[model samples]
Target: MPTISMFYGILVSMYALDIDKHHLPHIHVRYNEFKTVIAIPDGEVLEGRLPIRQSKLIQAWVELHRDELMADWFLAASGQTPFKIDPLR
Candidate 1:
């Protein structure tokens, strides 16, 4: 798994796997016992479950670091150096 970003110990990561014969541009968010994927760029939750508060936090993080997340996802998919998003935003 590649880590795209981190916020308050919550990690946004991605893994390369063929889903239905096509590679999807999505990333996973892991916090506590929560694990889920939110589609890149749009920040749409696709899998697993996150509580409302946690979900909001994830959304804000994704929005503030959209560029880094996308770049990291690409890098991870291409086997390049996985990028870490700045938590400065």
Candidate 2:
């Protein structure tokens, strides 16, 4: 997995394997021992679980970075830019 961004202590990453399967723009949130996949464009939860507090923080972060997130997703999928997302709001 390649980290796309970091926000509120959560590392946002995306995996090539994930793209091969899901084929959708998305990012993963990692905090402590928790990890959750967040679908881009719509900010939907795709997999795993996150604590309530962490989830709220990620939700806010995702909403604020929706545009950048999508851009990162495209760049990652297309192998244009290294998988690195912009900072959180």
The TM-score between candidate 1 and the true structure equals 0.78
| Predicted structure with the largest TM-score when compared to the true one | 2
Best model number under lDDT: 2
Q: What are the per-residue Cα lDDT tens digits for candidate 2 across 1-89? A: 77777877888777653577666787778899998888877778888989998888778877887887776676677766544656656
Assess every candidate by TM-score: 0.78, 0.81
Q: On residues 1-89, what C-alpha lDDT tens digit does candidate 1 reach at each position?
A: 76756777677776754133225667778888988878877888778878788788888877887787777767766767666677534
CA lDDT for candidate 2: 0.76
Clashing pairs in 1: none
For model 2, the stretches where C-alpha displacement exceeds 4 angstroms are: none
Q: After best superposition, candidate 1 residue 41: deviation in angstroms?
A: 1.6
